[model samples]
Target: MNLKGKTILITGGASGIGLESAKQFLALGANVIITGRNKEKLDQAKKLYPQLTAIQNDVSNPDDALKLYHIAESLGGIDILYNNAGVSNPTNNLAKANDKITEMAAYEMDINYISVVRLNNLFLKMLQNRPEAAIINTTSILSYVPSNLAPTYSATKAALRFYTASLRNHLEVAKSNIKVFELLPPLVATEMAKGIDAKTITPETLVKALLDGIQKNKFTIRVGDTKVVYFLSRFFPKTAYKLINPVKNSIKLSA
Candidate 1:
């Protein structure tokens, strides 16, 4: 719960939300380690924050995931695991996909869904042994309402949302101190949301909301417009779907 002195590991810490989180956590007196696929980016982050421990590990790779776990263990184990590594590839038709589209979709699943599960399972015991610990999964508003622009991304996040909910329930039943928090962010100004022309929040704003949510003991933290999206999807599924993918909805309506 307390950020001070906590050892936190953030996947995809090279840039975007993960990087911002690492920066804030370090400022809060936490020992932060960030994992990424880019060595240059990792080096750059280390330069910015000399206190940070940057590990070049791609979560999508099983070998890399194991390596990350061992590395974290060697760092005296982490108090928090931020499952923040993910990808989004815009695809018009999920089913009618070319090899490239299919590959991209598969890669999205591997990074977004599979990696989260692997890292959590690998680190669950270590977290449980700690006095206080947390697992933060960076899901998206598209977890509930489908995003036409990124069908695979939406589906994987939806899967993660469910899994995270289940994990929370399991931890509660087991009376474990390890907390599971789902961070659902709306369209944010990040590389992942590059082509998406919508009302987007900055990474700093999202990180502030995230820390606030964590402090309040909120398990499901929806930032900015994501809360509205979650509300609409909860009560008005069709309208939420239409709002997120107006063109497809209009085509369906016309048919």
Candidate 2:
């Protein structure tokens, strides 16, 4: 889709991939609005990119989500809602019966999965009113193969992957103008992936690929290693699983 003059709202835009996305989107002539829970990070982003409208918002909270809708409405609404906010708890021993396991899973699910649905529902009507609009949900390569070190995070992405597909199909059947796009990215050099020992892509490279996909109307945009995993997961499930969880890097968290 043509991004020039379009208004885009990106979640978790304070740093990493979100911040990079905001920069690139702005350079493309799109009016960019970004949201994050930390006021300091939001302020930093605004200072760095004076053109960005950075708002403090926690996507997991229902009230904050509604408030964000109103705030975006005040800015005359947005043409694209980029659900890029996500979280992953530190590696835990899932084999052990730890109370924190459930808590961590719930936290990841809320931000990484549920929040995407909530934001999409909140913006659905507004998006429909626009001449041309789109929803971008960031899933991950782990959605195709579970990461032993990040089980809950993998599950959340998997759930989102299915939801995004269903949402896109539903909109099409209803003859809606709003387009739904699912972005499956591989390990990227971001704050979230700091401790992981893996090959990584720069946020700039990832966002560039994303914009290209959006322009070409590629509904399922898989970048870098994600494309290889997607193919292997379909034809060589075992190899795909092993590729994500290499034996040498395996950590035994439980007896």
Candidate 3:
């Protein structure tokens, strides 16, 4: 769809892929609003792009999403909802860290999976008021297979993939103009992927791919390792899961 004169909202858009997308969209003459949990970061982004609207909203919080929806409505309604907020950690060897697993499950599930769903529901009303609308889910290459560094993060992305397909199919069956989009990115060199030697998917390449896909009407757009990981996971579900999910042995038992 045409980005010009459109109003777009991106979660976790203060930095990383979301930030790059905001910059691109703004350049295309779209009114971009980026939401984040950090006030300082939001202020910094506003300083950089005087035209951009930066809102402080924690996607992981349901109440915050509701509040944000209202705020977005006041800003001429939302034409696009980019569900991009997420977090990850290195879990190559998590051993017996129940605390860590618990934390990861809560944070990852909320930020990655639950928040997306909430925004979709909250914004659908506003989006329907528009001539056309789109929902962009920021899934990852790890959504198909497990990630060596983050088990929970991968699982949540996988869940999001399934949800995105289901939601799109439902909307299509109902004959709605509201489109569902999935953006699966490969491991990119960012603060999130620091110290990792995995090939980085450049932000520019990613945003370009997304725009190209949207123009071509491609819904499930996976760049770089996304297709490979998803294929491996689908064809070799058991093995891929095992590989991604490292063994968590009890040291007491070994002793």
For each candidate, what TM-score against the reference?
A: 0.94, 0.98, 0.89
Best by TM-score: 2
Better of 2 and 3 by TM-score: 2
For 1-255, candidate 2 gives per-residue lDDT tens digits of 999999999999999999999999999999999999999999999999999999999999999999999999999999999999999998876777788999999999999999999999999999999999999999999999999889999999999999999999999999999999999999999989997888999999999999999999999999999999999999999999999998755754443
Regions more than 4 Å wrong, model 1:
95-97, 248-255
Task: Rank by lDDT, highest first.
Answer: 2, 1, 3
lDDT by residue (1-255, candidate 1, tens digit) is 688999999999989998999988888899999999999999999999999999999888888899999999987999999999888875546445366877887888999999999999999999999999999999999998987667889989999999999999999999999999999998889897786666789999999989888878998898888888788988998988877887854454344
Greater lDDT among 1 and 2 belongs to: 2
lDDT of 2: 0.94
**What is the C-alpha lDDT profile of model 3 across 91-210, one tens digit per residue?**
534555466667768887888898899889988878877898899998888777766557678889889999999999998998888889999998876789887545688888999899
C-alpha lDDT of residue 1 in model 1: 66
> Candidate 3 local accuracy as lDDT?
0.82
CA lDDT of 249 in candidate 2? 51
**Model 2 ranges off by over 4 Å:** 252-255
- Say what the RMSD of model 1 is: 2.4
Ten-residue region with minimum lDDT total, candidate 2 = 246-255
Better of 1 and 3 by TM-score: 1
Residue clash pairs of candidate 1 = none
